[model samples]
Structure formats: structure tokens, C-alpha cells
Target: MDDRRELPRKLAHEHLARGDATGWFEALYAEADGKEQVVPWADMQINPHFAAWLAAHPRPEAAKRALVIGCGLGDDAEALAAVGFQVVAFDVSPTAVAWCRDRFPASTVQYAVADLLKLPEDWIGRFELVLEIYTVQVLPVELRRQAFERMAQAVAADGTLLVIARGRDATDEPCNMPWPLLHDELKFIETCGLREVSFEDFLDQECPPVRRFRAEYRRPATITSAKS
Candidate 1:
């Protein structure tokens, strides 16, 4: 583990001990006190796999609205904006959201503080592209399925939802912070009415070569309905 991850792990344990699953995020961000390095996953750049995915896909101007879940530091959201997306990126921590706004003072992206577990009603089926990276795995196992359901429900008709996360086998023990996801858990996205367009399970170019899963899904448009 990167020594930087230790603080969050400690914070999580403390919060979870108090039966607070989500509060740890705000605590972690607040503890960082504007220092990005204190947050383990703040890479400060668009994720390479995500960049490659964007490059491979069609850049249709018609599909413009995008949403990013748990967008710490806003790198992915900024990348989407650069590619012409009208983006909404959110984190559970207000401190993190403030950090993003301060880092990109002129950004058009709407960086808000919102909990994924309790999404707003207007957000359901509202986005043309949804990006979720490394957010769900940080949640407790009991909440993972619901988190996935919220993500799928946010996709507009015929829109895309791209998910990137640490991969794990069904038999593997998820005994750490950012608990990796099983293949079956990943398939829960499909259960929420999206069709899988592509799926990749590979070892990333990290220092120790971490395994990653990148999956693309799209909600089907039945042809009789409006974009609504």
C-alpha cells in the first residue's frame, strides 16, 4: 500500500467504528486540508485507461451531458469537459468539492457535494455519459449493489456509463480499504437494465501492477420514447 493510503484507512476504521460508513470521506478530505497528496487516489491527471477509452469512442457532439460520481480532485471531469462534455462531477465530501473548485476556478464543470447512496430525483435517467471510477469499492459490501443501481439509473436512454475499478475474483477476500469488486458484482450493472458494450480485466501499469476492470455499458433506446 502507498503510505499515503494509510491515513484514509485509519480514518475509515475510526468512522466505521462509530457506525458511520460515509462520514469518513469528509473527514479524510477535511484532514487533507487542501493537500492532494494526503488523499491516496488523487492522481492529479486524467486516468490513462479513461483517456484511451475516450479516444476509442465516437466523439459525437450530440452526446454532450456527462456525470462523474465521486469525482475526487476532478481530473476525470475536467478531461471530459476538455472533450466537449457538459459535465457534473460530485463528491460526498464538501471539502473535496471546494478543493476542486479552488483548483479549477474557471471550470465550467459543476462540482457539487452529494452522497451516491442518496442521489437526487432529477438525476435519475438524466445523463448522456456517466463516469464512475474507484468510488463504489470504497463503500461497504452491503452498499455496493445499491451504489451500482444508482449509477445505472443515472444513464439517459441510449447513454453510456463507463466504470473503472479494482478487480477481484469471487473467491478473493476483500479485506482492505477500496475493497476490489468481483465479476458478479460488476454484472449488477447489467441487472439494472444496461447492456454491456465492452469489458476488460487487465493488470495496470502501476508500480506493482494492480489489476483493474474497465466496463462500458449503455441503456437501450426502445425507439418509441423521447430522450427525456
Candidate 2:
């Protein structure tokens, strides 16, 4: 396998040297979309933890619905489906959606092209399980809070929201590209009323060790409205 460990940091270094990480994302995606290049979720290493987590949590077998945000190619969605969850995976790029559909023709998964930040109100609270793997951090820091709230609102009252994100130690340099999550960033979800049930950090040994957080949040079963 092509080593993924050094690539992200290398890209970040390039972006930092250029002093335009955000611009780099924009330019890269623009070229990718232009060339109709559909990036695959498998390319992101979504399996190792996600697959094991899904295996451990099984979704009760009766819970059928799932929503995956920013599903580039569909490997993770397919993994969920293989475990009996009917998944609706959505990405903003039409090229990515088309690529997923073509790649998984016989798979019991649906792929759609939609902006995650602007999901329709009708879709709110509709999923039994929501998978957000590294998507929130991709947004600029200014929009990160609002983006997380939107993601939390999409989960049903009793559903689970699975988050897998890259992180860095508080003392580490504030670099870009795969922007690491900060402590206050984690609090934004709590401010939106979602409760964190479990959290674990995965650390890998390499030249620049990889640090990531896997967390699960759930909406409360009961909430009193002002009118109630």
C-alpha cells in the first residue's frame, strides 16, 4: 500500500510554505471536479477504526436507516450496508456521487449530491445513525461551529452520531490541511445539546505520529420546549 502517513504532512508543508491552505483545498477540488476525478473514501483510511467500531456496535439489527456525510466514493457506506444498515451517502460533488453509483452498482446503498451545510429541514432528525468521518474539520475554523450544529441536528433523538477526526496535542504547531480538532471545537456539539457518550484517541507511531479521535454523541431522549 502507498504510505499515507507522510502525504498529509507533506501537503500541509507545501500549503504552509505557500501560506494558503484554504486556497489549496479550493484549487485542488476545482481541478479534481474539473477533471471529474472522484476521490474514494477508501483512500482516506476509513476502514481500520470505522469497521471495527461498526462491528462492535451492530445497530440492533432493527435499526435500518443510516446517513453518511461527505461520502466520496462509498467504501465506508458499503461497509455499513454490508452490516445490514440501509445507507444514504451524500457528497457535495456530483462527480463523486456518480463515481460511487458506478462503482457500487449492485450494492444496497444510495448516493446523493448535496451540500451538508444546507440540508433540508425535512431531513432533520431522520437518521437512526449518522456517520461523519473527518468532514467537520475540513471546513474553515470560522464555519466549523455552525457546521457541527447542522450535523448534530440531523441525528434522531435516540440515534448515534459517529465522528472520526484527526487531532493534535495542544502544544503542537497550528498547521493546516486536515485541520486538527481543538478542545473548544468538541464543546460546540455539547452546546447544541448532543451528549458525548464515548471517546477514544488513536495514536500511531511514525515519523510524525498520527493522532485521531473517535467519538460518539447522542441526542437526549427528552427535551422540554418553551411552549411545553
Best by TM-score: 1
Model 1 TM-score, 2 decimals: 0.95
For model 1, residues 1-228, the per-residue Cα lDDT tens digits are 469988999999998889899999999999999888898998899999999999998776674789999999999999999888899999999999999999999998989889899988889999999999999889988899999999999999989999999998977765689899887898989999999999999999989898899999999985786686
In the range 1-228, model 2's lDDT, one tens digit per residue, is 124324444554666567553333333444455343222224633457788788787465584788999886778999888878889898876766776787789988888878777886876998878898878766567778777888888898888888888876778898645678875687788888789998888785545767888889998876657774
Error of 1 at 146 (Å): 0.6
Assess each prediction's global lDDT (C-alpha) against the native: 0.91, 0.73
Output the lDDT of residue 162, model 2: 88
What number of backbone clashes does candidate 1 have, counting pairs of residues 3 or more apart or in separate chains? 0
Q: Give the C-alpha miss distance for residue 82 in model 2, angstroms.
A: 1.1
Q: Name the 10 consecutive residues with the lowest summed lDDT in model 1.
A: 56-65
Q: Using Cα atoms with residue i matched to residue i, what is each candidate's TM-score against the true structure?
A: 0.95, 0.79
Candidate 2 — worst ten consecutive residues by lDDT sum? 33-42
Candidate topping lDDT: 1
Question: Which parts of model 2 are misplaced by more than 4 Å?
Answer: 1-46, 205-208, 223-228
